[model samples]
Target: PAPTAAPPEFLLNAPGTWNLPMRTALASLPRSVWLLGLVSFFNDTAGELIYPILPLYLASVLMAGPRVLGLIEGIAEATGSLLKLASGIGADRMRRSKPWIVAGYAVAGLSRPLLALAASWPVVLVLRFADRIGKGLRSAPRDALLGASVPAHQRGLAYGLHRACDNAGSVVGPLLAAALLARQTPLDQIFWWASVGSVLAVLLTLLIKEEPAPPRPSAPRPDWRPGALPPAFRRYLVVLGVFTLGNASNMFLLLKAKDAGMADYQIPLLWAVVSLVAAVFAAPLSALSDRVGRRRLISLGWAVYALFYLLLGLAGEGWMMWALFGFYGLFMAATEGAEKALVADLLPREQLGTGFGWFHLVSGLSLLPASLLFGSLWEAWSPLAAFGSSAALALLALVLLRRWVGLPAQDGR
Candidate 1:
């Protein structure tokens, strides 16, 4: 049976019932969505705890440089991106998403603890690679499960809530890292502590509910090739790819702050501020996209991204970097969920795993070039040159999106 598409009670006009209706609207979502949100929250908490300090650890402890960091992040994401396609196809074939989701989380969860023992950049690279393989394995099917668990009308809100939980963990993780650092915990200790959240995340996965996928032999096989997807999805991917090419790994942003004289302990706090703003705004902005339109919100988000990049290129002061990071968070809140919701809108349910696989694959594959190019440009010319080029690309993508993609007809839930 299809998930309920009944208009949410929040849309009702009854006076005095507003608060109750809002709660009811959220309560109506399938239990799986809520559990998955918690799962993402814990998983991201573990990941983000390790992420903010990674650049510092690599630079100060492991004696690696910026270019090496770029390679590691780029290769890690690309590795995961490649696996997303295979995992998505496998999910459809096995007629189950839970096993993939559990396996992916477990793999990633297991990999983080090993980072504590990493003594060289190459070792870190290999561990990060393994971690991302787990990410790639789960991402598409996880997204497809979220989409399948909701009705058409609620997709945006569902994804928005999920991102909010994910971002909230981002906020908590960094603050926790900062607190731990203040207490004089060694970086390795922090990495070891991160495994706690990873374990909880994997455990939470055991309770999630998934509707059975179509039987393997009877499942509709959408061609995995990009050319075979709906034309609108292809065009959407084109614009997305263009925008993504400019979006380098965020480690560069923390590096920017570090270069501007921020303390090592302060980097996590700065990262937390960014995630705090993103967590606060993600749901409202995404729900707004549901009412207004995904394209309009996405266009505006890209525009904000361009401006943030442009200013970030010029920021020379720590205060300026702090302010600009908050702006960057706003950019994330606007697009992260809306982008996925748009994908769900453009493709049929049967093909969702493949569609999302393509989505991650494009973004992931692009990160290699994007990060490498940005790092190269920063080293060869100046940070201004690299960031300015990214801004220009974002603006160009925004224009193409507005001109080429129109409102897509909504497919049924």
Candidate 2:
């Protein structure tokens, strides 16, 4: 185990937290973290190819509507959320996450081809549910494993690079999808290629070498269960959960662009740019978080989100819509890895999986209602109502965060 600054309360023989390593290059990263980043790159590339186009697919191919899109995304996200918690509990008991990690990549990869055969919304839902089952199984364990590999002080960079690679693939996948769509390639053929990235992700995941897990504590486990997370993490969750209440699925962003007069094929290109911006900024912002503060970076991202969403609600120009898409990407770049690193900072090494699981659960479950509400509002009221309400909620979340969430000054470790 890496050296520690201090152990947490009530855990003897437990490893102390790790210190910052001298980070110099890609070579400075732990081999496992780098490999995992590659795995996320391919896996997310596969996912983004389908995801950016999926709303269009449902609308054009299956004759589904906006509510259908919202329902599918909400259900799929909820499935991942609940399973994340269950898989965390299981991973804690088993003490090795590699098998779950491998299985997740494999299942998600293998399921992509099945989507090609779907004839209706329900079929897509079933396949998506299966795919998210894989995502749920892998997410918490993968995060815990990644968090375990790096020092707490440097975690932002490690996970930031991972998200960068992940969104980098998102950039490539959508551009590729756009190019293919421009040439009039069939959607079914695109789904076939999706499996390639995921398969490579599975193979790459096999290359990562995990440290042997520390033994579980022998004393009777806390009766509060996941409630046993440190006080800081618990408090942070309140703000995180509320913010997620407005973090509707990204599909809505595309739906908004479409409403703003963008063509179906153009959506992929827009998404490619959004992802390109996210990929460009992810590493830099995350590295900055290590220097300044994670909470501040995250709050700034939400502030940007609030501004963008407010503009989205009232904007009249296509160019502004495009600009908002890029800003949306910037928001993701700012928050994605910083939030996970913040969670790691707040918890002990042993409970990292459970901590991430709870984060995923709360965030995703909140998304279900948020999406449902957004879609309902869009249908019953106007796009303005939906986007305006979202902007308001995001602002509310930022206020709550300032009131409740605490960030101690960094030690320059």
TM-score for each predicted model, relative to the true structure: 0.94, 0.92
Go through the candidates in order and give the clash count of each.
0, 0
Look at candidate 1 and tell me the lDDT of residue 78. Answer: 90
Worst 10 residues of 1 by lDDT: 9-18
Candidate 1: the clashing residue pairs are none
Local distance difference test values of all predictions, in order: 0.86, 0.81
In model 1, where do residues sit more than 4 Å from their true spots? 1-21, 214-220, 410-413
lDDT string for model 1 (1-413, tens) is 35546544345332112355545766787899899999999998989999999999999999987788889999999989999988877776565788889999999988887888999999999999999999998999999899888877787778988998999999999999999989989999899888889899889999987887644555456568777789989988888999989999999999988988898899999999889888877876776676777888898999999999889889888877788898899998889999999998888777788888889999999998999999988889988998999999999999988888655754211
Q: What are the RMSD figures for all models against the true structure? A: 3.0, 5.8
Give the CA lDDT, 0 to 100, for residue 361 in model 2: 91
Error of 2 at 11 (Å): 36
Q: Judged by lDDT against the true structure, how good is candidate 2?
A: 0.81
